[model samples]
Target: MDLIQRLDSRDADFASQLSRLLAFEAEQDESIDRAAADILADVRRRGNAALIEYTNRFDRMTAASIDDLEIPRADWHAALAALPTAQRNALEAAAERVRIYHERQRSETWTYTEADGTMLGQQITPLDRVGLYVPGGKAAYPSSVLMNAIPAKVAGVAELIMVTPTPDGTRNPIVLAAAAIAGVDRVFAVGGAQAVGALAYGTETLAAVDKIVGPGNAYVAAAKRRVFGTVGIDMIAGPSEILIICDGKTPADWIAMDLFSQAEHDELAQSILLCPDAGFLEDVRAAIERLLPTMPRADILRVSLANRGALILVRDLQEACDIANHIAPEHLEISTEAPEVWAARIRHAGAIFMGRFSSEALGDYCAGPNHVLPTSRTARFSSPLGVYDFQKRSSLIQVSQAGAQTLGRIAAELAYGEGLQAHAASAEFRLDKP
Candidate 1:
């Protein structure tokens, strides 16, 4: 089977073909939207009762009340203690790295005094509460728990509540351990759109949060989109993506496996390689065929590769970088002699893995960078999840009498130009008689 599509930069239709390949419209699923709307409304109307009913119906649990679903602080600590020594150490180490990295991103309040004794600056403050939704059941992601919760904690969020669905009364200890390590204030065994609603609208038992973060299924995504205005949410993520620009110096097998790392995420996920060396592209193709069968998720990897993966023969490294900026992929790896040299040319990418040895997987786990990144060309305007996402800024202004007189005329003129008589008068009233 020809597992990957091959393209050339010289082709007349290359730009259009690449655009078609990159196009992914998350058109609203009417059914999912209707279901989410109903659930959100129900949660808003019924609060705790609705949460309990949905929890039992969807998660296959028999909890009578919201309290029954809550996992206490002691259990979180116990889950952390119960982990194997190696797992515990790795989780702790990853948490520490994530914390240290985000600490540098913390914004501080600053002010400057004008010559007229006017004060203007900005003040930074963390969100009072936040909600993190972790996908539960077989898709347990302890790494996500660390990624979402640690930043909120680092930003000094007063309360961080997490909710995950435990189908059939099953719980994932690793996820719990991550929550514990990340200093989550509370945990509940609830998920799906209903959980999103509960977080946004607040159940009788659960306090409404200022923002909700983390990834989930389609239903959850739709729910987040629906509740965005009522509460803040992280980006509506699309499929995982990885774009590699190889100068053809790296080992073929290494490049092949790097492509597979993102392809295995799901069938819709995209993995593309841009190389100037046609021979090296062929070598990587052979390596992919050799190594793919050995992957545990070979079926998924195969479909993903066959459907969305590509090997494009670019004219040179500069052309590859140009194409990469156009795609603005979620994860970009530069496998070259001086990765930094090419990386500086990249204008848009969620995260850049510099050098041949730096794998995208490191950023996913313990590389000290947030793995939750903008997807689907959103890197053009969006950024990775960090402390800034959990923090808010307020503009500060203290106008002295003399400063107000000087500023009022400018404000009045702008308001008058817009035909806002009330605004013009309000500004004019603050002006001193000349």
Candidate 2:
């Protein structure tokens, strides 16, 4: 009964209770931030020397220079070839699907001429270079490599540089294989805030990147926060979250396991279920109790479910949609008879898994959609990582003399209204210039 918070929409304090359960203010540990700041500063000041020093001290490497950390192109190809047949095939399959999906998102340079001969349009161009940070050591996730790198390549990025820590000189072959499959241009065996700093501010050998992507530990997040202006970065991600709206038709066991998918992510991750049927809620509770002990990360699941997870009794599917919009969770699964009907009613969520068959886990790996999504209720305004994130847009303006006469007058009027006579003169000069 105490596994997770239980709430009823009929209760007077239900809204307040749900708010408290959903609230998650990630710890801004000043110490970690300060440490990250110091590392970034050192790397920016000393370049390759600082990068090698941190790589040696933190990852236990004895590299003499930058060349020692740069993984050769042939090594990436070797890793790809060395992968077991099934693993290699799966990585390629995932990469191909991601590429296909993101290729549709690539924007092109477009322009249209007006009647007055003013050509206006948006020109889309890929970044010159980008940095991808992959978590190394025991947290190697080859899937993440596909999710981050494939989109950049699909966006026509010229160069994709990947930096992953090799703790104790142990490189994750799977990650390397993924990078090769994703068409990454380069690989470096370095990580941490130092890697981020080196990417943002070029080292002696490594050129600076225009943008950086991929997920990492707390230090990586802090480093991204510090280097936002110097280089474009993906969002500062928060703890994962999953919310399921079941109409009691789906099996309770299915719903229970669905909740466990995100809960297993970490102790801070959250999972919640909204159902109109009280009996089904209890059935899911029993299923959670039965399945929790069997999980390898049962301890983490217990802490996560106990602290942030919830089972709420909503008035109906309509009310469930309303509550879901309020929560704006990272992942939403509409497990019901007609998920589309309810999905249409919903307005906010990072990714929606419709029907009983569409699980959130599938979306995380190979659902043809980018898994790097907005979190911490950021779905309200932000979006998942895609080719668009790797591309930038510039406005095209070619005004003919006649067209300029009109546009210039408008601009000059506004500029003069804001109080500058020079602006008015500029427009007046162009008004009748032969």
Candidate 3:
């Protein structure tokens, strides 16, 4: 069986074939949706009692009350203290870098006054509270905790609540240490659709948050979709993706491992390579076959590479850049002599790794950039999760008496054109008499 699909851009059906490859339908599973709907409704109605029941059943915990499920600040500090020096230092260093990067992204309120004494501008304010959902148990991600929480903290969110499942009542100290380092205000041992529900709708124990951010499983994603109007949520992400535009000069082994890094994420994750050198493509393929066996997650890597991965032969670097704009992959790597030269051609991509040395893995953890990126071609319109995701903007307008006379006439004319009689009258009322 072929390990990865090979395509040539010169083929007549290349466009359609590439579309077919990129197409991924996130069809809602009936069973998962029904389960999430039932759980959300039950939690909304029963509040804390429902949280306790679901936590016990889903996470294998024996918690009898909400208080029992809450991990206090002291516990977070203890987890940080308990971590080995190396791990703790890494977590703190990563958190500080993330914080500093997001601090530059923080938007400030601004206003401007005109000669007529009219004021207009934007007022940027932090959300009152935010909820971050982290995958727990064997998939515990301390990096995820740092990536999601530090940006919200830097945006000046007043309170940040985190929820992660602790199956069998076993907690992950590294995650807690990250929470402590990121300044998460509260931690709860709950997960799945129930936890999303509890955060969307105020429960007896957990107050409802203004927005929810972070990644989760299918059920959690569905719950966030259903409760979007009730509370704002980060984008519903798809499988991880990486597209490398190599000039065929980088070592084949290096490019091969770069593809595997994203493929190892899951069987559905995608990794594609585009280059002009047919010989280099073969070299990378050989490297993949040679090195794949040594990976710990070789099974997953093989499935992913065979299922969604590809190696395409383009005419040149320009053709590669044009095709990349169409795919708009979640992570793009330009591995060439002058990466910046090709990078400037890329208009669409969630994140771009400038050169061969800038691995996507670095951006995922400690590159001082948010790793929570738009996926599944959403990069065409969306962006990476950052401080802006945790902040709200309000348009400020204070019209002076003289300014109102001038603006009212224009507003009334548009309102009348739209057949909104009340709107027209309201604007006309502020106009000065002739």
Candidate 4:
């Protein structure tokens, strides 16, 4: 079998082939959904008792009470202090960069008054509390902690609560240290649907959060979806995807590694390249063959690349840009001579890495943008998580008497047209009688 799929825009069946490649229908597993719903209901009904039962059974914990799952603030600081100098420095640096970037996104309340003394504005306020879920099973992503929590703190969230599964009672210290660095108010070792339930429906020990933001596995994702109405949730991200638009001027090795970055994430993750040069495409193909063996995640890279990755030859840079708009990928790398020229044409993407040197990996770490991006073509409408997600806006209005005279008439007329007598009467009540 070929190491990875290859296609040409000139092919007659190319459109259908590209559609097939992009198709990633997340199967709604009824069984999983039911299980999650049951767990949520249990948590909602029994509260702390059910929380302890599920945590103990699923994560192999022996907690006598919900209090047992709470990680002390002292432990968070101690985790920070205990980190090796290099890791600690990198974590702090990444946190600071993320904080600085998110601060720029903080929404502020603004008001404007008309000549008639009518005032209208939007009032921005932070969420009272937020829940951050960090996946703690396969790998410890301290970076997830930093990305999810720092933005909430930057938005002036009053309290930040974190939940991560500590399977077999094993907690990842780095994640704890990140909690300390990110100013997380509380850390709970409970995870899975139970943790999400606890966050959405407040328990005796853990209060319900205004919103929950983070990534998780199948059950956790299903749980997030189930509890969305009870508590706001971040996007249910699909497999990570990266689309690179190369003018075939960048190094083949660089392009290959960039593709590998997302592919190595998992077997479902996707990476693709769009270039005009056939010769350069071959060079990148050769580069992928040469470098795949050296990666620690070569097996995952191999499977993901073979299954979902693609290399396409476009007619020109403009064509590549057009195709990128069609895909609306989560991560876009415009690795051409004048990247901005093509990036300007892009209508949609979660994040655009301009120039060859700006690898997607950098953005995942200290690059000052949230790596939690909209995946699976969701970039067409949604956006990356930021301070904006942690805060809400309320429309402010204070109508002057003269303004009400006009607005009330309009409102009553429309209300009466709709046959809502109460609404019409309410509006008419504010008007001066003839």
Question: Estimated TM-score per prediction?
Answer: 0.98, 0.98, 0.98, 0.98
**The 10-residue segment with the lowest total lDDT in model 4:** 135-144
The worst-scoring run of ten residues by lDDT in candidate 1 lies at: 19-28
How far residue 206's Cα lies from its native spot in candidate 1, in Å, is: 0.6
lDDT of 3 by residue, 1-434 (tens): 69999999999999999998998999899999999999999999999999999999989899988999999889989999999999888888888888889899999999999989999999999999999999998887999999999989889999999999999988998998899989899999999999999999979889999999989999999999998999999989999999999999999999999999999999999999999999999999999999999999999999999989999999999999999999999999999988999999999999999987998889999989999999999999999999999999999999999898888889999999999999989988988887
lDDT of each: 0.94, 0.92, 0.94, 0.94
Candidate 2: tens digits of C-alpha lDDT, residues 148-228: 999898888999999999999899999998888888999999999999999999988899999999999999999999999
Q: State the lDDT of candidate 1 residue by residue for 1-434, as single tens digits.
A: 67898999999999988887787887888998999999999999999899889999998899988889998888889999999999999999999999999999999999999999999999999999999999999987999999999999999999999999999989999999999999999999999989999999998789999999999999999999999999999989999999999999999999999999999999999999999999999999999999999999999999998888999999999999999999999999999988889999999999999998899999999999999999999999999999999999999999998898888889989999999999989878888876
- Candidate 1, backbone clash total: 0
Question: What would the C-alpha RMSD of candidate 4 be, to one decimal place?
Answer: 1.1
Local accuracy of candidate 4 as per-residue lDDT tens digits, 227-301: 998899998999999999998899999999999999999999999999999999999999999999999999999
Error of 2 at 160 (Å): 0.5
Please report how far candidate 2 places residue 61 from its true position, in Å.
Answer: 0.8
Give me candidate 1's TM-score against the actual structure.
0.98
